[model samples]
Target: MSTAAVPDLAVVASPWTLGPLTLPNRVVMGSMHTGLEVHDDGGAGLAAFYRERAAGGAACIITGGIAVSDEARGGPDFAVFGVDGADERFRVAVQAVHDEGGTILAQLFHAGRYALVGGMVDRHGDPQRAVAPSALPWAAARGVVPEELTASEVERTIEDFAAAARSARDIGFDGVEIMASEGYLVNQFCSPLTNLREDAWGGTPEKRRRFAVSVVRAVRAAVPDLAVTIRLSGADLMPGSTTDDEVDALVHDLLPLGLDGISVGIGWHESRTPTVQAAVPHGAWLAYASRIARVVRGSDHPGVRVIASNRMTDLRDGEAVLADGLLDAVALARPFLADPAIVSRSVDGRFDLVNTCIGCNQACLDRSIIGAPVSCLVNPRAGREVAFPVRPTTQPRRVDVVGGGPAGLAAAVDAARRGHRVTLWEAADELGGQFGLAALVPGKEDYAATVRAARAELDQRGATVHLGRPATAADLVGSDAVVLAPGVVPRSVDIPGVELPHVQTYEQALRDGVPAGTVAVIGGGGIGVDTAAFLTESPDESLRARAFAERWDVTVADDVLGPLPQRQPVAQRTTRPGEQVTVLRRSGKFGQGVGLTSRWVALGRLRDAGVRMVGGVQEYLRIEPGALWIRDEDGVERAVPADHVVVCAGQERLEHSLESALASAGVPFALVGGARDARSVDAVRATSEALEAVRSLAP
Candidate 1:
């Protein structure tokens, strides 16, 4: 091993060769489901999507899961190799990426018991049933048990894998990454919990390894010159699953198979460890990849590249990881969704201009989980590159956006990008309206980065931003069009002692700390859940691997934290551990409106904080010095005692007088975001509305 000092940026920018392919840099655009794979656009939108990202400077791109067979299809949105005209579509996508000087790969995937099948038909016009190693059903999708693949059927599946690889090479792909990670078919065969068979496939460790080994061997024989890589689960993060020693042994056994690369994947879909959540910290899973890298480097094929992935949101973070020389490359999936030009912007030292992924899951993962069309919350034109093309308009107009929140900021930036003269005004001293408040929450520290990037983009586009005051009606007199997004105000509950001195709204409590004692909070919506997290916040929500694992009950193996895991903390102060917080809800889930993937994690944090949760409250009678009176759903009146009170009922639309004034003066104006409708503080809807509003007002 060589010991030398390389600048952090230089480390990640350095290029390396993976067998037949020579990548330009260490950043790989990792695979993510865009939900546009099955769109009826003849693959035009999908082709354009990858084309722009390649042009933006990703060294290599990995396509979303491409099923090897119809039974292996994950859902209706999955693109299969030989079904539904996906082969012709993939050929176009591959050419598009190559034209822009980027290499693309086809990830061969099989969902096993995780497949979502309903109306899919086979060759004989019969409903296709999901096939797995055993006849067990994934607990998450309880009602559907998968059929155990017969001995002959399993051998045919191996051939199907080989056939898919041959087709991928024929279609002009630079590589083929066998999907053996994230609780998929290959991963299921490795885990004892999922694979229960007395046959040659699952009697022991070596037998369990047969399926993945045979698949890799077949795929390699079919495509000899192509990069033959396999993605393996470095850590399943599931209790009573595959052990670390078993995982390392599997890699040791596959060393002489002429493999080109290995990409490390972490966690399972059913794991509760919070692997990719915002609270997991940046580059939290690198140690798993480093461990695999060490195992490979000590073997005969040390030249095989090893890639680290998961929660790598910034290039600077990736640079730091590469500086240690433990891993060869860094793969980022969602960061590319937040900014396709991330590689170009970060390499050029334009960090402020890069839109960072906040890990809110509002638009990406939440939508993809349910098979909906996926888009970015910050970069709205992510999947729709053709529909929302960014170019100079033939005729530009003077457009003014009021309120410098999520909606207003998005509108102002997009309007300026279209060659319009744009100006944004905010009543506060700074921008980021609700985002500013959100940044104060414990796990949401990344929200502040969004504000920083948005502010820089406004300046770069020559769009003026006025702070410390609201947009006056006179200021909009000469504007050709006005977009109002004044945002929302807290709604007051009709309780008798609501205006008590000790009571405060959710906004005030988040911005300024509440009283340091027992507190009773009303309502259990998203904001209320955030309030609970804030009130019961730790002295410091640590970014170190051990602390995170300990907090979430993930038993990390001995040396998985790596050497440089603890250099910073999100917060560090004295916390009142014994302080009690009682949360009351009327009727529903506690963390409603929180993203589907994130709600459980947030609730887990609150549970660890020793919060007293009570639901089914029918009435809020009154409040006094010691406690608040309320009636329960059991037809019983009781007093919830507390030292302080917080109300998080909901939000109301901020009535903009400027809208009526602009209309009276014959100025064309439109209300967007919370100023138009304030059902909840929905940033996904806000950014979507802002994008549509700006595009509709084209020159």
Candidate 2:
């Protein structure tokens, strides 16, 4: 296959300058919470995190929000710029990025009322108090109200900002971006909703802008040669919050402070109008930055640059926004998590190969909230970049990838990229296996993007793809190693009524179509409920709603009577009146078939969708010319009506007894997809295992 032409991804030189430096690219690595910092040492881990991105291709890497004062720290692990004796560590972090040929920026911040001081103990092990504009706490809690910043305290805080900036410059940082957005301290003072003080720093927009403007001015003065940037919230997006005009007026007033650039972020997750809770589309936050750019263009600060960021994942979106003069640069957060080489791939015209972020939030923000090391849901090698760097093998070997799902694809891509000759075999005509079924769920189209990206990468790396081929142990006779990635198979119970014509497996219903109407899905496991939900779609309601309805009809059957034990909701599940749905759950060990997280979401959706729960159906009997006859837990036989029955039980690993047949024939073989295992997770794992096995056998 001929190589495709790459796109022109060269960074445009901006005429606008920042202090004594000029950025070559408009792609800025925005300040992101990695939850990898060590509270005690504040060491090289955080520094290396920034340096890796710099080495990957970011023009400017902004450090995660670093609190300038002890009282303003949001969490215990947040990096602190004011920590005593921490200057050397911060200097090393800055130098790491500088050594990697990238500009580094420190984001100085104060959490204000958002501070978890009382919840977070000081280094002395004393519980601290949280401070804010008013007595208002976060929406989720009503803990201790913060004492309003006194006139002297406010002045000291401004000095802290300047001091932090000065310290950042001393540590070799190219500049400092004041984090004034996302409902932090500066943002609290900037908005009327948060700052209700009668002091000079409150009331009107001009008064509210005082604290931020002072910080910018003081920081610029402290670090004359270092570029000073302001990260502002263009609009609070909260009810009774700062309006666009109010934000515009504040920007206009603050532009003359000689700041180098502006970054516009959105929504406070804890605020009534939190960005995380908002259902806004991708790049929805760019409009605010565009408005800021227009305001700056009208003012004397035409040379001031503007950066836009908010869930931006596609380079095309960034390119269009920049081309239209909406903003000077676009910032991406999750996309970088999904694929660190996004810019490199785009420049190489391999957009299809880009492993797109599905916005599942499972590994990124979700994991951080639970105090786990951050990772990507689809890409397991995210935070482990340095630990598991993909290097070319000294000797080329043949690698066979049995399953073509996410894990298999990742393994194949990695092995092939490492200079191995890889062969990926799929039992099915297409790839993805169970993930393909997942894509059919509402709001899950993004999952399919992972498969597409894997296929693209495999094609690019010249991995041989053999479709509709199932390999056995004999196929690995001459191979030095063998990987068994045969995917999973459905685990079906030998129920009396399950053999009826209306009964079908979840996979069958997905690949083949079922008539729309009332449907009873057996088992309330993730796959069962998900399969039921996928059938509820009519191309009218939102995908989320349809998925919810499907989830509702699925239930966990309990044989012990009383009430059915519930699983957590996966997608929002809802069912309309008169919708035909029933869930049968067996007692004891028979019902535990799904992962905990997926089970929760699935159960929640099932209950919300009004799915009927029928438990203890061990002795179901078919009633001729009417409903089906069944026996309850008390050994009582009963009759229940149903149009179609779908089996959603668990799956088993793939088993092929024909290994000797193919191996004896001296066939170069591979196994792929669900033919490896009945379980989805195992199926993905098998793909890589199979690939490694093939490589070992290759001479």
Candidate 3:
């Protein structure tokens, strides 16, 4: 497949027609916490980050969570849009976006009870009280005690919104979005759980809606010409919280104030539904937006547009929602991170070539929480556009890529895009290596999307993909350079009874789709743990305890056990009554590489499903009558019955063969992915190394 003739992305001719000014496009780059703006020079890096997105194709890019005042700053690194006389820095940022033919919006926010006052003071040079509707802090860990804003302070806050809007207009911004969602100051006041005030600002649904309406009215009055959008939570998702009816009433009341659009998301931070928030399918929150759109469109505010965002990554789904008239525009977060040219691809019908976001949340939101620069898990050049622009090399070179996994596919796509003729060879017919298994896990369908996108990109970039062709020294003989991305092979750990008829590797099990009656998994690494979780039935505490006692010489005093040391938190425990399975970890630690949020959920599920976890398995030997004997790490030998065993000891580097072949053929080469190293840490490190290697060879 050749994609050399692909044209540049199309530009939006008219974004909006607001009385006099004609905006560029309906697509809005919603504000997210980029964390880059915490640095001095008023977040110049952050300014450039937004500018690049605008340059790439966003009609309007909203700056990160910008505080309306010092006390309202949520995080240590939140950008301050309310700094007195800081209009010059914002002007520079707006000019950068304008120079790139894109409009910019300032997102005005107040953290309310969500403010990390101590951290804010440490970073921004001052600490102030966080004003909320009622005197209740949002999170206990942040140490923020919310103070009720007095009548005078409430009036001042209304003025603050107006002032912020006016400042955005003065600094050359085309619009400002009032953030009343995700449990920010306005959202906190809107929720019944947080807002208990009596003086016309809390209690009833109408009262709780007062603060947001006042803010919106004030902002609209301050900047009548600016395109003002209000971001609101369509559903609070908390128990005893604001219902959908209340949200509809709130939007209905605010519609008369001349608001331009509404952006809806789910939950406050504390009440966030992980299934809806992170793990569920794409466009999971579309129903919430659909409900809001139905209400807004049904009301007297017929001209007002609706922007639907929240896991709306699939172009087809987004287009369907648009065609259905459920939304005027779809705001994407991770998809834009994966490929800023996503809209362009969708418009051009090259949707398959669009690199999709896998919703891992590791590099994006998780990293932000940990105080690191934002980036994409798959696409390395996210948020670093200034430093790592995609430009063609002055001179063309021939490159050979061994293996057809994520890393190899990435290198091939990037190299071909950089004006290189590339040939990618895979020993197997399939491209994705371990990712093929990763896709099988529940709530991981997006991994398949990432794989398909990479393949499409290689095809579109004019790179030759040779399937089922293992490259040798002869194959690399004439290549100018080679990239050794041949991934690892499963390691064989010698243990007695391991040669039993049913023992097999994870790859073999996946490939063959074997079914076993009773199974035991050996090893405690990420792959091992995942394999154990996959093979074992659901969690059941009583049944699991009975099985453990019967099969292995172990006794469980408690029905529910906490996560092992160095493991992810376990949320709940139950048992799968009839399922027969036991997981024996050679290492003392369990759930080692799981993410904090996922670990809790997965562990809870496993415990509830009756999977027996036996830690500290030492020596293994075959016993009489087809049984397996094990010596505990405590030096006590015991026998455990197992009908089948699965080895999940994990993979090791298989690059020596490819490296030797390349060397023997005198081919200049780079190494990438797990082929570069055996450990999981090699994934990112190898990608970075491969990029550097290509840059060094570029002419």
Candidate 4:
């Protein structure tokens, strides 16, 4: 098999000037909170993490948002630039990026109303309250209305920003970025929905913009030598929030404040809009940045560059956006999390080997929200880059990895990379077991790239991949060691009438089209919800044609016989009026195995599609001709009518017999993935476990 050639990224790989510094390339590592500073070492873990991206060819590495004041502090674990000994603590971090010829920026932030009272106590050893421009809280911050900031407090906060900027410059940072986006302190003052006070800093657009402008001007004056940049929200995506028209005026007012550049961040944390998810189109927010850049171009400070960010992962798209003069630099966050060396690999003409960001948000944002150190589902060594360095093994041996899902593929690649000969066998015709099915789900197609990246790595490392080949005990005889990742077997619930007509498994319903009229899925987990979504939301051709006409801004002619085929709403693609899907689970809440970042979207899609959801079924009585009887949570018996029943109860690990066979064959073996634990659903668990297993093996 021949590998495809890599794309030419000479223009994308070229240098560009930002203020007084000449960046090595156009790619910028956008600031992202990793939650790795939970330790008492004062950001050693955080610094090392940033160093990895700098070494990987990032031209500018922006540190995660660090607090600037005791009242504005988010948590004890967060990096603080306004506190004592801050300069000494960040010295090593600044030197690391400089040593790699990469410019580093300190993202000075203040949580504002988003700051929790408990977090304040943890950070300052004294309880403090949150203060906003007005008494408003984010949608997620319900029941925690903040006390409005007094005029005096606001002035002090501005001074805090200046002090933080001065501290960053003193610590050897090349620049300081005021985080004014993402519904934080400055954004709260900028947005109409959050800022309502009739003071000098609120009420009117110009007044609301006063707070952010003051911070920028103060920071510029405090640190004359360091570059001053501001992160602005391109779109707040909230009702009554700052609109694009308002942003136009806001940018016009801020450009002359002695600012060096602007980074356009999109959406707020409380936004109902899809911002960074895989569902959002790549470079969808470029227009927001382009509009801001145009505003700057018309100003006296046209040299102040606009860095386009949010959902920008593709190199080709970045180059095109930059070529069109839409943005001076492209910022990527999760893509760097997936592949720290993405820019280096692209420059080396090995783009095919680059691990692309799937934008699942499973391990990154979701974990950080729950107070866990952020990691990546595709890349295990994201935050632990310094801890998990791949080195050559002491001795080489033959290894067999059976199964080609995430675990099997990961193990095979690890073994081969460690100077061992590896053979990976899969019973299916293609790789990616459940992960493949997940990618096929609507709005989740980005997951397919994960499998492609793993396959490319396996091939590049000289691992033999055998599809449609089931490995037997006899095949493991010549192997020094065998790693069995045989995947999972769907476990069908034993309902009395489950063997009746129109009854099938979730896989069967998906592979073979479900019967028309009505469908019922048994289980409310990610798999079950996805199956229901697949059944209810499959696109129709007539609907697609109408949508196409509307998207192209074309006026379609009415049909000669009557009106043209009517378009169905994207959220309500139920095929026909009578056709519906009912999803049932043993528990009350749905999306059992879904990640925190994607759960709301998944459930929202189901709700918008009008899928009937029922939970807390005490028992499954039986299946009848047109109805299935079950005991409700309250011990009341009920029957749900359906045209077809799809079972997505769970999976059973079937590695016992294989284990016995390998033992009888005198082969030492280890179990991985679903073969070891069928309960493990997320790819993070499976791949991490597999890598640990391979890392411990004696050659």
Top candidate, metric TM-score: 1
lDDT of 3 at 609: 57
C-alpha lDDT values of all predictions = 0.83, 0.66, 0.68, 0.77
lDDT of 4 by residue, 97-168 (tens): 787778999899998888765544634466767778988765555467788989999999999999888888
Residue 447 in model 4: lDDT: 67
lDDT of 2 by residue, 407-508 (tens): 567667777777888777677888987778777665355667788888888888888887787655544454433344556767877766577677788888
Ranking by TM-score: 1, 4, 3, 2
Comparing 2 with 3 on TM-score, the higher-scoring candidate is 3
> Which tens-of-lDDT digit does each residue in 320-361 have in candidate 1?
778767789989988888888888777777778888898888
lDDT of 1 at 660: 77
Question: Residue by residue across 1-699, what tens digits does model 3's lDDT show?
Answer: 111212221222224543233555545677777666665565466567766677656766777677887777776666666453356667777888888877777899898887766644633455666778888876543766778998789889989889888889988988888989888889988888888888877778888888899999999999998888889887776777887788989989999998888877666777634432233434556667878899888999877777777765655655455654556776776777877776656556676777777776666776676667887766766776656667887778888888777677767777888889889898988887766665544345456676788888777778898989888778788887787788878878777656666788877754554465666666665565566555553223234334433432222222113211111122132212324666678774566656544555455445655767778887765533335577888889786656667677778887457676667667788777677777663344555555555655543
Reference-based lDDT, residue 233, model 4? 91
The better-scoring model by TM-score among 2 and 4 is 4
Assess the local accuracy of residue 523 in candidate 3 as a C-alpha lDDT between 0 and 100: 64
Candidate 3 lowest-lDDT run of ten? 559-568
Tell me how far candidate 1 lies from the true structure as C-alpha RMSD in angstroms. 3.0
- Where is model 4 poorest over a 10-residue stretch in terms of lDDT? 559-568
